[model samples]
Target: MGRSKSPVRVITAVVAMAALVLAGCTKPGPSLRPTATTNPPGVFGPGADGLGDTYYPKAGNGGYDVANYDLDLKYDPPTDTLTGTATITATATADLSRFNLDFTGLKTEKVTVNDVDAAAEQSGAELVVTPATGIATGAQFVVKVTYGGVPKAFDEPGLGEIGFLHTDDGAVAIGEPEVASSWFPVNDHPRDKATYTVKIAAPEGLAALSNGAMKDKRSAGGWTTWTWSETKPMAPYLATVVIGKYRVKESTHDGKPMVIAVDTSLSAQVDAQMAQTPEVIDFLESKFGPYPFDALGGIVIDDRRVRFALENQSRPIYSSAFFEAGEDGTWVIVHELAHQWYGDSVAVNEWKEIWLNEGFASYAEWLWFEDKGEQTAQQTFDNSYAPADAEMWRVPPGDPGKSDLFHESVYTRGAMTLHALRVTVGDDAFFKILKAWAAEKAHSNATTPEFIALAERISGKQLDQLFDDWLYGEKRPPRPRR
Candidate 1:
């Protein structure tokens, strides 16, 4: 995600920043390793409510690993209602008679487990489901939930209003840390990544956009159904659906599907900026190995409420504020597209390790500017380090508390950490460590320690003290020296 409500140029001078339902048998894919233990053979127990994330303990559920989510949804713009059926395919990691899905707002009309009617009740933001029968460890089961209502956005303390936002012409489902629950039943954390098949039914004239390749689109009656599929395992937060009137442009880039959508109300300059999508991807690919997804594109929304741009897997969504006054917002584009390699493809194991996502992307912005001959990365790092704020040095980027997750220190200092490492290890090993990290941790979740280990291994340097000082130290450390 990019910085909140700031122009790319202003933010650069300051600091670097920061779903459908369906019920069906999803193809078997990679599953998150279960964090909970199995019960006795015949014994049954309820799945844990949360996945034990340090920042948000109640964020994701435990005891099952989700493989896919098939969402068939219909939205009425005039009435602002969203009705949908979500089919989740998952494997029981333990003996479970009941499990929990993180969900909010909508009224659940019905729920079925493995085709059998199951009892479900909404508790706070969770949908507690009691299966008719017990599921053994390693047993795959399908959960179908039929629900509908006016979706509501989550007003987090520091994160602001997120989740589902009801717009004028349509709606947008986007957020970080936890947005999936506001729209669909989900595991809700990066630890449990899954494939997605979303079928959205919207008014015929409006375009519905989502992640990955478009599978099918057909209009019947007054509504058009847009079907999209993402075969690559993706974190729940990375899944998004934007519905509204859009000037949609579809093409192919490097043998991959490219779909860019801009709000119809936006200026032609926005379209021109969107045209730079492929160029940014090619530049990022050269440094980060191949692009990780099958599709590439972006969605530029015209809502002032959405102040930040998010790296939503294959297709990212940007706020129009980035391109105000026809400014070149390619730096923000680079920040988000770079996340296709760091944050989206290689997600953080826990929210605390967000620097793994924000840091690398911030560094990518510096790299892009350096490539353009505007400013070298070393120079950018020096600028950020020169007048470092006390708060920035006080709050460690490695473990910024939940409230300070998107704080300036996380992006600015996080990128500084990488530059410091680059200075320590030299360019050859630095770039090699980056490519190797992307290749090794592709389509998976990782942690800061794991990254430090990878950097040490690839560069053949002891980097613990370096990482500790830059990532965790409360005081600013001395500048890097070879």
Candidate 2:
């Protein structure tokens, strides 16, 4: 969160645009269809994934079951509808409630649990389904959600960009996690994460691709069904899909295949804007853990207008607009890709800790400059925050009891806390702490105290005052004389 982002501003952003796109799923608008911008449905025409497949329950699933999903959906473009189900398989844990699901804008015409009808309710944009027969430990159950709608510009309602913005040119949805939910049902938040098996049915000549390696694509029934899947579990915010008349630019990194997907209409400018995506990927691979997913690639949505780049799991969403600014592309790309390790893989327990996600991502951006063998760490540190602006780190925990949910306290100050720790704990332990954080908490949410404890354990030094001064304290320490 930036200083410009106040709590009132965030509330307005949510109230204005709550349901928007992220990556895998889509959200509906607050309008009555026909009169309002309603989502079209029932894209199931031919060559569907067959009703046998079951969809995974994202949040409300009973028990603490963590498993990957194999989603097979069938929908049509002409009717602006979808007609296919999903097959979600997972292990059920004892300590749990119902799992949450992100259904995007799809109006649930029908839902079944283990082939039995499950009752669903429409609260706001989500379709809440309480599973029947309940769930037990080690038990496996299948859920299927079916519906459809026109894709909203992949964005959240409150703070949104012109998603699928129509320039003098064509349209592409290039925002982050918000966009995915615009057209599909998925897990809305990051805490509960899973792998995705994506299949999109579009009219002929339209191309579709997602975060992972391409399994198979076929054309039939006057529509083309493109199916892609990821091997690792990713946040719902990172599971992405890019649909357009796209041309694929393929490459390889560390023996894995990569692609830069550009909509055919925008091919002329691809050479200029996307030229550095591969380079940025190479830089990130060297610093962070290995590229998070099996494949590395991106979908070019807006040629410009986007401020932040989202490391949408494997399929990163790039802004066509920022191609002209060399520094903008450098910082945003590195920031988002760093999320591959900090934000994407090891996520926040709740939305309040979004700073833990974004701040670290921003830190990763500065670190990118350091790794380029150009800037000094102190120079980068100074560049990150000037003298008086250091108060950014004073934000309280998002526990609601502690501090505001979002404030510059999270981003600038979050990074500053990390920087302050680096100064206090020394470089060796600091870097080791980071790697240990990633290695230990992969696929789980992390809190500020958890990070603090890890630092103390690794450095063999209790950082009680350091933690207080940097993280929990109400006032920031005076800036060290430059």
Candidate 3:
């Protein structure tokens, strides 16, 4: 994900003030403690309500691994209602009497576990399910939940609004950190990747766009159901559904499906930017190895409220603001598409290592410009290093706390870290490290230490001091040199 560049001091101050005002506004979800059950003593216990993530502990449920999500959804624009059934296929990782799913806002009409009626309850954002029979470790189970509501965005204090946004004509389901729970019952973290088949039913005239290749589309009565299947394992946050009037272009690139869409309300230039999808992917593949997903495309949203472009799997979603005023937003395109490898395919194991996502993508933007003869990467690195942004340097990109997840250092300084490695190890070994990392970690989760280890193995260097200074130090390190 990338936000439009703004003044550093202004953005930081605004975000800081927003955090203060919104502090303690949102309530925490229930604990992940084992709940009492009427099964054999100590044999069956409730699954933990949350995964023990360092930053967002309650972000995902524990004790089960999701395999696939089959979502059948219908939205009525006039009434702003979203009704859906989520059929989740998962395998229990431990003995369980009951388990938890991250969900909120919507009213659950019914729930069933493995074709049996199951008792369920909603507590805060957690949907606790008690199946009739105990699910043993390694046992596969199916959960079907019928639910509906007027979907609402999560109004995070400093982060702004995210999740399901009821738009003028249709709706958009997208966000970072946590958004899937607002729309569907989900595991809700990058650590648990799963395949998806999304079937969205909307008014006959509107377009409903989603990830991967379009499987089928049919119109019945006054509604149209659009089916999309993302066979690749994708983090829950990368799944999105965009519904509204759109000018869509569908074609095949290199024998793979390519679908690009722009809101009818935006200028034609947005479509032009969207047209650059194939070219950008081709360029990134040369540096990051094969593109990780089966399909590729982009979505340019008309909503101005969306200030950033998210690297949604298979298809990245762009805020129309990026292309406003006839600005050339190709760099934004490169940043998000680069995430197809760095962020989407090889996701971060923990949110703290976000630079693994943002940094590599930001560096891709520099590489793109250098390829276009606009600026060399060394020049970009020199400029960033020369600057004395104390706040940026102080907040280490590798461990920027939860509040500064998108801090400037995470992008700019993070890129400089990569360039420093290139300068230290030379171009051949540097590119090799990148390609090898993508190839080995494709469609999986990774971390900074893992990346550093890969770099060291590829380059034959003891680079602890370099990573320590660049990624963790509170003060800027010495400039890079051969």
Question: What local lDDT score does residue 367 receive in model 1, on the 0 to 100 scale?
Answer: 89
Quick one: ranking by TM-score, best first? 1, 3, 2
Number of colliding residue pairs in each model: 8, 58, 1
TM-score of each: 0.94, 0.75, 0.92
Mark the regions of model 1 whose C-alpha exceeds 4 Å error after superposition: 1-32, 37-42
Error of 2 at 181 (Å): 5.2
**Which regions of candidate 3 are displaced past 4 Å?**
1-42
Q: In order, what is each prediction's RMSD in angstroms?
A: 4.5, 10.6, 5.7
Weakest 10 consecutive residues of candidate 3 by summed lDDT: 20-29
- lDDT tens digits, residue span 1-482, model 1: 12233433544543532411000000112443645545667688988899888998998888899999999999999999999999999999888989999999889999999999999989999999999888888899999999999998877654567888989899999888788999999998888889999999999999999999999999999999999999898888889899999999999999999999999999988998889999999999999999989999999999877778888989888888778775567777888899889988888887888888888888898888788766788888877788755578998989989888887778888889999999999999999999998888888877788789999998899998999999999988789988
lDDT of 3 by residue, 1-482 (tens): 12344333222322232121110001011222112123344487788877766788887787788889999999999999999999999988778988999999899999999999999999999999999999987789999999999987886534578899988999998788788999999988788888999999999999999999999999999999999999988888889999999998999888899999999999887887788889888999899898888899989888867777788989988888668886567777888898888888888777788888888888888898778766688877766677686577898988988888777777777888999999999999999999998888887778788889999999999999999999999998888766
After TM-score superposition, the amount by which residue 480's alpha carbon in candidate 3 deviates from its true location, in angstroms, is: 2.1
Best by TM-score: 1
Report how far residue 15 has shifted in candidate 2, in Å: 26
lDDT of model 1 at residue 435? 97
Q: Compared with the true structure, what per-residue lDDT tens digits does model 2 show for residues 107-135?
A: 66777767888777765445565666555
